[model samples]
Target: MPETIFRNWTSDLSRDWGKKPIQIDHSLSQNELFSKDALAELIERYPIEHYSLMRTSSRGEEKKIWRRGEVGGLSGHEVMAQIASGGLWLQLRELKLVDKRYHDLLQSIYGEVEQRVPGFDSFNHEMGVLISSPNAKAHYHADLPGQALWQIMGRKRVYIYPAEEPYLPQEELEKIALTGLESALRYDPEFDRHALVLDLEPGQMLTWELNAPHRVENHDELSVSMTTEHWTEEIRREQMLTVANGILRKHFGVSPKRRSTEGAGFWAKAVLQAGWRRSPWYKREQRKMMPVDFRLAPGTSTTIVDIPAYVV
Candidate 1:
């Protein structure tokens, strides 16, 4: 049987999630585990759906827009196309819970990976489970905190772009982040080179630095995976302050405490901004960030890995 689900089960995900560069071959065997039948079951069991039209405040006009359909909705692909065309803020959550067969697979995989490196908690409430489809495109946006995507089952092709140089601006990022994980896109047209292209199969995992631009395409017939997000208090505090600032800017049309934002707010956005800009925090943090690589054998052995903390 699978381990009992804890409301705080995600506590395990944050520990040691980003302490060192990741290496997975030591923890699990190098092989794929899920069978074709298992993959088919996942495809048929989940209810797919698409999106209707949505309206967003663009400049001064009420613009008509649409997004990639929610997980259980229809025309998920069309929703994505619409989103790519006009851009929208999105937050895709899992509708159908995972099954025992899949949950058991994760338990075994986690066991082997966690034995090596431990996990660290960022003390945030955000935790997520794998959906039936892996085709969810996050667009070309960067995150405030780091993210680790584990391929519990099926295969996916991931394209990653580096941070720094031709960076995405603040206003665009704030727009999406303020939208509350809803349909939004903040892509940079000038970014050069695809940093990494990965063909992730079962038991394999990947992690990239916070705000690192990346997109995924589900290659196989169906895909299932877990993406546990983490962001440090530092990152969260900055985002919270950004939201607060955005609220003031939009709702009341007033800027608050900017007289000298150095010592203001919980985490103090001004301090973080200065540190993030001048200091080596970005590079140091990037160096501390690592990719989690995992592979499992066809039989019964288990695998495990830390689900590091993120700012978001």
Candidate 2:
């Protein structure tokens, strides 16, 4: 482990932490845990419920394709090799709960942040490692929690757009809060014109404003990255408001205007959202599991065999 996770921290970085899209140099790429061999070992033993293996469309393709798949009996190295071959990405989610080393690393990263930024306390911290194929693209999406992307290996181009209006409308965010679908936001190619585009390399990490809409495209090489998510009291309150407002608009056919996070309106909406969570409707409306449509071929590195669709 490096003595310092962030390499080029400055007063400006602390000031702009979550207010805008900022990329900073980091030392995690030097950590031995992120080495290809170590990652392969982790993947081999990772719990099925803690990971998501997805196959998506290649770059420049008109039609979009996203399917869930499984690793089957392949070795960890084989899985990495398959991803490197193209059109696939694996997310080892919630690393803190899956591995103790990662749990400690997560704590260390946040501990350093709290030390640098006074009064910025965050909780519900989670980390996921993403291994992606060459020329793979993650379509435009917006997340509810505070997010940061850290590049450990390879390179990727990231486009970050403002977290408002056509890029990330409030209703779209509200729907995500209710349905737990991050990719529900609509995207326009013209939005790229106003986006802050940056190419991320090893040892670099990017953080943007809360709920900012962004997309990623991998260079013609396999990419490895870590994504971190956290929530603060303010963020929790905003989420409550989003859910409550969504319920009003979706279920009751009522439009909510106030977006305050305090006082009577906020408390009332918070209570409403809490009640909605316990209702039968909430259970039915939650995101459904994606069926496993394919599995890695037994001995072939890049071949995937189609399987009878089944939910894991």
Instruction: Highest lDDT: give the candidate number.
Output: 2
Q: Tens-digit lDDT track for model 2 on 1-312?
A: 547999889999899988999999998898988998899999999988888999887666678778899898888888998898877899999999999999999999999989987788999999999999998888899998999999999999999999889898888889999999887889999999999999999999999999999999999999999999999998899999999999999989988889999999999999999999999989988889899988888653467789999987
Model 1 Cα lDDT, one tens digit per residue, 1-312: 533222122333345345321313211112232343443344334433211122222223356522222222223343333333332322223322345554444444444335433543353323233433324333455666656676655577777776544554445455545554422445554453545677877666676655556767665234555555556655565566665554455456765444222353644554544454454533432322112221111222111122332321
Off by over 4 Å in 1: 1-119, 123-138, 143-145, 152-155, 163-165, 181-183, 219-223, 248-312
Measured by TM-score, the strongest candidate is 2
Model 2 / residue 234 / CA error / Å: 0.7
Off by over 4 Å in 2: 59-64
Worst 10 residues of 1 by lDDT: 294-303
